[model samples]
Target: MKTILNALAEPNRLQIVELLRDGPLTVGDITDKLRMNQPQVSKHLRVLNQSGVVEVQPIANRRYYKLRPEPFKELDTWVDSYKHLWNERFDRLEDYLHKVKRKEVDDE
Candidate 1:
């Protein structure tokens, strides 16, 4: 997970991942969409591959990159843990607001 986070921390790498989210893309396709030079794109792709954030498939002569499910699943699970806490806090705040509204109406 640390490796995944580190790889995604780069602006270029994050854009690459966003491009891949639509579907698998060749390095050329990514380069065209991002308007980045081939070598720079390739370097980011290599780091993403090493971090297990993206997987490469060689189809004929072209290499296609796509997101790996496991790392993203782990990330989702980690985020869900925090999601529950935030939901609880929001729920409590809503309740307090409702009570205040009721108190205002009672005073009127």
Candidate 2:
């Protein structure tokens, strides 16, 4: 989705998502791990949450953030649609390179 892509477009938010991949983390933990201030980390987390890339679980006082799989799975599916195109192009390129190498060897 556009919203999910836009949310991941920001470097900080992308990094936050990568961090969440390992497991759930509190805002403070994210801030400390990223070496960023609380407000900045919180803002990135808010964007990720809004885009449905991450979900939060509130345990009494602290909120822990974790990846919600679906958005990323959707992204993977979209990318897969173009996977064969890349493979075809790479195969063509490889064939051309092999021909060039054979020609050079013959010349030598």
1-108 per-residue lDDT for model 2 (tens digits): 899999999999999988988999999999999999999999888889989999999999999999999999999999999999999999999999999999999999
- All candidates: TM-score: 0.85, 0.87
lDDT at 14 for candidate 2?
90
Per-model tally of clashing residue pairs: 0, 0
After TM-score superposition, what is the CA distance of residue 9 in candidate 2 from its true location, in Å?
2.3
Task: Candidate 2: list runs displaced more than 4 Å.
Answer: none
Minimal lDDT window, size 10, model 2: 13-22
